[model samples]
Target: MTALGPLPPTAAVRLVKEAVQDAYADYGSEASRWLDGFTRQGGQVFCGAGCFGCCNMPIRLSLAEALIVRDALNAEKLAAVEAHARQVLANARTAPDEDVYVRRHRLEVGYCPLLDRATGQCSEYESRPTRCRDTFSAFPARYCTEGYWESLSPRDKRQYARDVARTPGTDGELHYIAPLEYLSEPVWEAAAGAMDRAFGLQVWGDFWVLVSLSARPDFMAAVEAGDGRAALKAAQAAGLSHPMILEIE
Candidate 1:
């Protein structure tokens, strides 16, 4: 309700708690029963603690995810979010051309502004992005480092992404990254990119993540109006080359 900013630690905790409580009222009891059944039915696996590994991965999220994140962020916490954006921009500007892909593969520097460093856990763990909540390790039987892709060569990683995006039959998966190379689905990507352009979060990353973030009301409005492209052209006309608009498919 209050102006969002960099929220204080206590405030962040309170927001997360409130959100989780509301969700519990809606689905918690049923979902918990299901999870219990899943665990009992030989679904239990890794039990590592203090694993910041998964938090660092370039996990894609939906626009709803960004809204949830923004809604959870208190006034004080907004500062941290803004700072993160600034830092990302700075990194992009200074990175050498050849190293551009390499830099992106590296884990985002520093703990997420949303994390509680003292506990080494997400302060909003309960209300964390759905992708984070849903993803599981292929080898849950083994304790694997979560940000495993950080070690991959940029070219190989991009190629793999392309393959996944081009491959068929993954609509049922809870979380999957967009393959950058192949374009199996065009209209979806274009619309998603338009949404990203509307939001001013046009930087290339995970397509789904960008599209999901761009689905914010404001972003959706601009994109649906078909004026987001106009805005881009105007920005370019004003001498801003390479504006941070979404990459259209």
Candidate 2:
């Protein structure tokens, strides 16, 4: 391969978009293959279409990925995204750090803004962030549910093991989603690298928050302007997201 240096700003932006898209598509394919092989080796994956248990958590995304999500939304959905972003920011104000925000915010806020409460489904499944895409439960759906794991008694744990043993092809132990995570990291790295080159920084954070910011024309302009500092300033000015979440560097 030929050695390469930086491209023009516009070209870099386009490449980042492509990188994220490729990452999304690539993970889907690899996940399917991985699940197939694991299942063939007696692994059971509990992730089904209607299980939105993991949807309540904060999803992190880069500016490019967030923009993809933003473009996928309609006006009403965008409104919901902004509303959810505001809630995240509000809740974040009290929390001293991202860990606190993540732990407390999900329980307080509940359900992703993109989730349809009526049915446990992502409203914008196709355009979901890479983090959301990577979510596959190795444990039971209840594991994803808040307080479910804590509520489980010792007997309940044994019972679950027994049930897994009884179930065909399962080995009475949790399956691993690490392979999927392994696959997801590179995509994000590619996206982050692209964003760094194009936007002069990799601005990323909570999914809804970043998506909401990406929907802003001013924010997008700042990002595309290839000035990282200006983009960071615009992110702070939004006042709808916490710096901890809407990080720019």
TM-score of each: 0.48, 0.83
Error of 2 at 8 (Å): 19
Q: Relative to the unseen true structure, what is the C-alpha lDDT of residue 195 in candidate 1, on a scale of 0 to 100? A: 38
The TM-score obtained by model 2 is 0.83
The Cα local distance difference test for each model comes to 0.42, 0.74
Candidate 1 local lDDT, residue 138: 23
Candidate 2 on 15-124: residue-level lDDT in tens? Answer: 77788898788888987887899898877678888888878887778877876777677777787777878788888889877677777776887788778888888888
Q: Which stretches of model 2 miss by more than 4 angstroms?
A: 1-13, 96-99, 153-176
User: lDDT of candidate 1?
Assistant: 0.42
Q: What is candidate 1's lDDT per residue for 117-181, written digit by digit as tens?
A: 67667777765654455444322322234345566589957765665454332232312321211
Q: Which candidate achieves the best lDDT against the true structure?
A: 2
